[model samples]
Target chain A: MAASVRTIAVIGFDALQLYSITELIRRENDYVILDTLDEQCDIDSIDAFIITPSEFVSRFDLFLTKRTKTLILADKVSSVGMDMSVSVVAINSRLSEIEEAISVLLNSAECGAISNSELSARERDVLKEIASGKIIKEVADTLNISVNTVLTHRKNISAKLGIRSVSGLSVYALMNGIIK
Target chain B: MTLFNINSKLCDIIFYDSSVISVINRFGINLGVGDYTVAEICRSHNLDENFLIVIINTFLNEKYFPERLLKTYSITKIVNYLEKTNSYYEQFQLPNIERHFNLLIMKSNADDGNLHLLKRFFDEMKNELLFRINFDRQEWFPQLLQLGNTTLDEDIELDNIPESAHPIEDKLNDLKSFFIIHLKGKYDVNLCQAVVSSIIALEKDLKQNNRIRERILLPFERALTE
Candidate 1:
């Protein structure tokens, strides 16, 4: 049997904001766009409800959980309900981070895994070097920073992502298109 | 009586306007003259305007004729003067020397279009050698040998044409080697035939290279065969 065409509805008032997100996640094979504000426009057939954090929190619900995965394109965690829904977190208007967030949301939906968060630039630099199998000292010398500084970034990366090992960092990087 | 007669004749010749007198003393016929106009002078001189112009054009190129004076002289008069002065003679340099050879190459008689650039190459190489070899006569052979090293020197910062491999002494050897190596470098041909063909081609190519070689690639056949 032929597969169904996956449809996605982008929800945003700002054209620029929508442009940024669409530009990032525009390459996905199984997606189409629908209106973001059309709430009752058949949530049953939709695979994911991607909501802006501001929009999602305003319509926050407890029982309105788990028809499809819910993702919030948010800068900070604002609302909490008892039921589990994924949050695609980005940081202070970082464009690259926002792109990573959309890609992570799409991947998580495919694998039925947890949502991923944005990486800081230093964390990304350290992860890239670490992924290349360079030792901490070598990465430090190349980056022109102290080894302790690299260690600090690694720790921050681990704490932020809940991944402890460098191998885990490599796996995360590969999965999310972080390092080549 | 004879001494007194000689002095009297000399004074008469010097003092009076003998423009009317048809008097000849020695080797040549002297045309007794009267100044009227240039047209009259030319007519009395039996000169053609057009023919005299060509003669002036040709003789004006003689090194001895001051250019300003040549332009001022009626072409016919200049031609007349030039003929009398035997100004068309060529000064020959040493026959076997390179400069003399270059002069021969430059002259119209030696140019066969095919041999023109070989002539130019000889001239350029001679000039370069003269300028480069600057010391007294003793330094001649050594300086010639020194300039023969055409390899790029560290002192030269710009891109330079690779030096001709054939130094004066080893030109024949270098030509032979060039023939051997490049004869069939591009196409398949027997060594002897290819050598002959490539040398002919390379000679032509080197000539055209100065004018338009940068803009267009000349065909191997034209350089070689014709």
Candidate 2:
């Protein structure tokens, strides 16, 4: 199954480099690239920022870029320097490394939404309880369902989502807002 | 250290430090399981003895975290433990502080305006601290536990979680200067120190939580990825 489209903005990458990153993301069809961080672009709505060293002037710029999902390109030592806030990558050239970096960042970004079209209400409850760290018996007790019924719901949820492990379900639950 | 021989009661962990009752509560080990040895009670509850020991140690001594010892525990367990610690503040400690703080305000024998300001600022700071904690409980901790679990087991990798915001630390420092130091110059040195200690203790608890996350849990998670 495809992930929900991630909206990304590229800043300070030269035209050729910008084309490469956006092309890579769009080829996957999992990301929608905006031309620039413009007035139409809600600062909060922008999912990730891939900014190059030449463009990286201040923390203020990235602070304005987005909150959580930022990838800074560093050649030697960028203006952001050793600041532990935003991720600073050493490679400025390789598109594959760039793609891998972007994927890792996006995956870890805490931004991205999951659609809830397929999940039933019961499945949603089970997901939330499991994700919030409740064990199966505890979840059964809380929901006032039979333990076997809770197990059945969990199995159905895993089958529908193709995510079997409790940890995987937990990630799905969090990403999909099945749990707070 | 509280010893637990076969004849010893299971409740000594709580008896040693009443706060520890909250920690064990996260493991669903209810109080008053009489005279069961530590090993016996752990077996009865099906709680891993080593895991329980590490949790108790982490709660008692913030600096004593052994990341490898903590590896057996799951993300859910750690999150629950941290959440319980967070709750201890607003549920028990913060209310106790507020009660005495009200008494201090009522018994103010001085004509100073800063005392009144201190009362108001203290209330706001407590609210802000609580609000930040609630925000973490709802948003940050869920994502964090997922991140820890993901990076630990799968090929997926996540960066270190950004440190949480503690705006109240600055507020508490301001209180120290405006109210506590001022009180020392005025009449009640003991009262000033007592309230200051409360603020310091709360700050310490929050900081220790941050340390446990950063030091023990994150390292353990990273090691799993490795």
Best by TM-score: 2
Candidate 2, B46: how far from true, in Å? 5.9
lDDT for model 1: 0.42
- Interface RMSD to the true structure, each candidate: 32.7, 21.6
Native-referenced DockQ of model 2: 0.01
Per-residue alpha-carbon lDDT of candidate 1 for residues B158-219, written as tens digits (9 for 90 to 100): 23324333232122222333234322213223433433443333332223221221111111
lDDT of 2 at B37: 67
The superposed Cα distance between candidate 2 and the true structure at residue B93, in angstroms, equals: 2.2
Error of 2 at A115 (Å): 59
The CA root-mean-square deviation of candidate 2, after full C-alpha superposition on the true structure, stands at: 20.7
DockQ of each candidate, alpha-carbon based: 0.00, 0.01
Query: Between which residue pairs do clashes occur in model 1?
Result: A8-A32, A9-A34, B201-B223, B201-B224
Give the TM-score, chain B only, in order for the candidates.
Answer: 0.19, 0.66
Candidate 1 per-residue lDDT, tens place, A1-180, comes to 234555555664377767755666666555765656464777556665566766666766621564355556656655433233354444354564445445544543443332234565666888889877889999978876545446545654554565544544554565456776
Residues B64-133, candidate 2: write the lDDT tens digits: 6556545456777777777877787878667766876776766667664446656766787788778967
